[model samples]
Target chain A: MSCNVDDSDEIFDDDDDDCSMEVCTKDSHHSGPSNMPESCYVKLTADDIVKEQRKLIQNVVELTKLPGHTARQLLQEMKWSFENVAVLYYDDQDKLFAKAGISVNGEAIDAVAVRGSSGSFVLDQQTITCQVCLEDFEREEAEKGMSTASGCGHVFCNACWVRHITTQVKEGQAARISCAGETFVEGKRRRCNIILDECFVEELLRGSGGSAEILKKYQTRLIDSYVNNNPTIKWCPATDCTNAIRVTDSFDPSSFDTSVECSDGHVWCFNCLDEPHAPAECSNVKEWRKKCQEDSATSNWLVAYTKDCPNCKVAINKDGGCNHM
Target chain B: MDLKRLKKESVELQEPIEKCGVTASPIKEDLSHWKGYILGPDDTAYAGGKFEIDIVLTSSYPFEPPKMKFNTKIWHPNVSSQTGAICLDILKKEWSPALTIKTALISVQALLAAPEPDDPQDAVVAQEYKSSIEKFKATAKLWTERYAKEGSMESIQPLLDMGFSEEQAKDALLEARGDVQAAVEKLLSGA
Candidate 1:
């Protein structure tokens, strides 16, 4: 049998004249029953064609109702060699028919086909099946699963969908998150909320391996804040003393560092190299020193009352005027 | 289920079409059908040939297998001799929604690398595949040389010239390791 090139062109572009010419000739070839087989044509026009299509669709529904394997096998057989496939389905035991137009061997014909009973169509309802398992609503409630990409209505169970998303994210290829059978706009589709969804999930449950470092940094920030805001901190200035710092306003040289009483009867500041002690505390020591000079009887008592000089590490002795001592 | 979410997902699906190397462009007027082409597999008898194929995307694309039919002439055991129907499961039962145009192209390339003998689209090729391994490989090579080679359309004339049965000439060319001249001579001697 010769294939008219023009008929092939009709498959891709319907408007070209040269192809239409060949199509015209091919049509004429089909019109003559004198050259064609009788088995090729069954007389059912208009109403009969619709009835036959409904019958075929009903057959598909019956086969789909059998089992999974049976449904799939029935689906595979839906294709016809000729044009025009009519699909019929049983709705409430009443048959509804839809016809598919096809071009077979350069001949435009109608083939009757059906989307097996396994497929469900409700008014205003669009349902998708999982491509992996080829299952629709039987696994769980429809509300619980994630639907496939746009234009394609395949759905996956939530757990399966999450796992798929996670794997894609981990691979650094999360941009592709389409359903198995859906086709998207070429050059226009972009990956969106999938990345955001992944981020939220990652926040909810810390991942196994790499997140420990982030957690550690957060803990360190907490520690730094606590220490800076604490109330008690003081710094000891003496070179020989342990560095004990407290967060307080009171300044006690004896508590902080070594202290010294000057020859002029004042407490000396070692840090500033100046005299800034309380005037009462400073002059009283001087007065006490003079009183010790006048009375030899006060010597032992003075020694018992006065503490050692913190700067020089020497005991106070009134007998020696409390300086070299 | 939300409209916004649906719109966002559709935007994501268009990405692969740009990256797929194959020209699988759908007419702007109708998005369901597309035309694509693949270069012949290299380092084989079918080098330098270009093959055209039609891709029909259903509403369930990415989730269901897209229908693929060859628009160009090809001679392969895994593709139907008459209808150019392919026997790959990725296009049918084993279809995954995650597969992209780029991946599908790679799959087609891989199909060329390894044709499935167990599930041959053409039964005669399947028989040849089962009974004689050497004959099958040689015949496949011959078919490629004759049908898929660049400017290989010349191979058709020799069989017709020598009045050799097209099938036998193809087998002989395969048996002769795709040596066109030798295949022609064999046909001439038989005549």
Candidate 2:
């Protein structure tokens, strides 16, 4: 008859439990936004995180799903992702790639690397779609060594770029290795201090102590960057419209702006428009604007002034009116 | 808006309108629209007469271009008789973003001195200008006298009798340089 606890004991115990549970729940609710939903969040051991990352990589592979020939060809290429990799959505016709949350370390990688013989890495079967040709590699004719700048992760084949960087440094034509997506400060080439790499590699090197040489190298590299990063500047790309946009970092070929100057002095910005520049620097500049007076004074399209119509009070702007008004 | 550049352009546009003796005054109440005047070019039939024109600034005023039409009526190869339409390159393909109102007005003045007969808005006048230069000059001169001269309409009854509309008659007389007889004869023949 007496499985029930005594009245005094039951009352005290129930009160303590109620207060503890309330405190616990309040704290949990307070930290709710910081935590992912249970299904999305798992306590990640170091190995578990790596495995989950691998699964994410698999998702990219599944998404791309290249045809048989393309997949095989990509496996033979040297393209690769280092770490913090994710799927980058690309629109081939426009040559635009959307930014995604998946990052390889702090830097974002578009390509993934597969380990090759003797610690070498070849392009992963999944990510080696050559952005240049806009097609998968079919034949592997050349073995071109390549590297990326630590600051801006632009990739380039050695044969096309190495001499240009060396010459700029030799001639004092450049101060740093600056490219479209990234800019490296002048003076010394740091060892491969990329985001994912924990230790500097012995093979990596920096400055030869020549400003001119660095300039030449960077300038050549900069052109390569332009070639890689900007496809919009080639033409208006508007259907059937034949306007071509001249590339300038600070200048508008259509209008004049004396204040904005391109870093290389090769381009100028106008009051009306701006040309292309290294994306990193260009994005920092504020949205393009023209003064109201400047635009009104310079615009070729005439605006008709409107007064409230006497009969209807509707705004009416007359196009070719004489001062007869 | 770039204030410095606008100031510079305003200065540039103002100087020539004042110097070339053209009407490039801004609207008193609004700077967006104004009336421009052109002293008909020297040695042309329109010479010795002053013509009024309207200039309206557009929303896309500087980048695209403002629309300008001659308000004054004169018999010219390129001006439309019915609507005072002006034909000029800046209004068409040669438009540039940097052009100012003064430069455009100056261009209109230059067009007055040398109307392009080949690209005429008034085909009949263009044909006259091309095939019979002297006749074209005389007709233009006569039209200037009747429509543009600034005397009085009472002295210009012959012009009113011509098929020229009443408004045209009045406008021609007002624009004529005190030559009622020439104005009347020209209006009769042209009408």
Expressed as tens digits, the lDDT of each residue in A179-273 for candidate 2 is: 21111113211111122110111112232232443444444443332222332233222244322222334333333222222112222222212
Docking class of 1: incorrect
Give chain A TM for each model in order. Answer: 0.19, 0.19
Model 1 RMSD in Å is: 40.2
How well does candidate 2 score on lDDT at residue A280? 20
Worst window of 10 by summed lDDT in candidate 1 chain B: B1-10
True contacts kept of 1: 0.12
**Model 2 lDDT at residue B44:** 84
How well is each residue in B30-139 modelled by candidate 1, as lDDT tens digits? 45666666766666434556667777776545444568877765656677767777777566544444455445655665566566667677777777878986776666
In terms of DockQ, which candidate is strongest?
A: 1
Q: Which stretches of candidate 2 lie over 4 Å from their true place?
A: A1-325, B1-18, B28-30, B151-191
TM-score of each: 0.32, 0.32
Cα RMSDs of all predictions?
40.2, 27.0
| Candidate 2 lDDT for residue B77 | 79
**Model 2 lDDT vs. the true structure?**
0.42
